[model samples]
Target: MNQEHDAGPGRSGVSRRNFLGGGLVAAAVTPLLTGQAEAKAAAAPTVDGVAQVTVRAAVNGSPVTVRVDPRATLLDTLRERLDLKGTKKGCDRGQCGACTVHVDGRRVLSCLTLAATTTGREVTTIEGLADGDRLHPMQQAFVEHDGLQCGFCTPGQIMSAVAMVDDEGGADSDDEIRERMSGNICRCSAYPRIVDAIRDAQQVMR
Candidate 1:
């Protein structure tokens, strides 16, 4: 016991000098290691443990490319990444029909569609429906007929109506318009006016 006390704490294999030296070494190297990790993350950020990717597509008649997570929904890519907020997100489960958009001339639920799948394809949102300062026929019809109240669901309704009219060569009657547009829901109960708008736009879209 006397000999150990004379040798001090170093007899236990770790001295105060060695402990302090190790701490200083760690402190000096920590910042460099942290900086390297930050650089790597900034270069290629990941999502859900999966690496992001570059997706290219034609949007609103223009070529567009975006870097996003592979699992990102088209709705998120449109509204968040590309800043195309005209396409609203409602009932993200594909039930509300608020995220309707045209893909290669056909209507699709953007909320249920993946951004990665749009590569090399054509995507048309409400923002693309206008030409210069003039609105699309469907858009004008909605305005003239008062087809919207709160206007939350107006974009999807207009998009679906445009595609429906084109697909059926015209809705023919109010009943047909209602049936074809059943997917889109208007919370303000603007069904009658929406039908009227579609019918009116049909004449011009043809």
Candidate 2:
């Protein structure tokens, strides 16, 4: 005896293909809905509630003042507000030295430094490394030695090299220079050329 049992109208059996199709549809729609919600949230004005403060500092030998959020970092203020794009935003957590800059002649990670804390201090960026038509010796050496590949990390590497030379601690020896410059990461892995450039520039800088 063959008897067919009807699965109720609201409880129709789902085939494997139908189940997979339904899952795929749900997965595609989820991302679309998430993106739309994120876009809407991002479109909303956010400055209305955040506090901003004025920070005064000498940037690249020019006296300047800018208003920034209290939580804004020196790297953001330099790149966004002051239009100094040479200081790159990499890692943004101080792990990568791409945001390296000189504050009062000392190398510091700009991303970890608060913009407000730099008030009344001399902040030197990569743009200030050159003198009019003449590039800094370290910069020239970097170019001559082909010390960079992608060049995104060159500015920070050069800045840190200049400071290292000025500090007169590690520029003399390859091992020392490598140790000192380890903070600056060049994903291009141009280590040998970078060391050579620093050594060459150290001689000319002296």
lDDT of 2 at 163: 93
RMSD (CA, Å), candidate 1 to true, equals: 16.3
Q: Indicate which candidate wins on lDDT.
A: 1
Model 1 lDDT per residue over 1-206, tens place: 11122323345678634543311111211222122343343343343344555567888987776655566688878876677899998998899899999999899999989887898899999999999899999999999999999999999999998899886576777888888899999999999999989888899989
| Candidate 2 C-alpha error for residue 202, in Å | 0.7
Error of 2 at 65 (Å): 0.5
Worst 10 residues of 2 by lDDT: 1-10
TM-score of 1: 0.77
In TM-score terms, candidate 2 sits at: 0.76
TM-score of each: 0.77, 0.76
Regions of candidate 2 where Cα sits further than 4 Å from its true position: 1-48, 168-170
Scored against the true structure, residue 101 in model 1 reaches a CA lDDT of 96
Give per-residue CA lDDT, model 2, range 137-195, as digits (tens): 99999999999999999999999999998864546589999999999999999989999
Q: Which residue pairs clash in candidate 2?
A: none
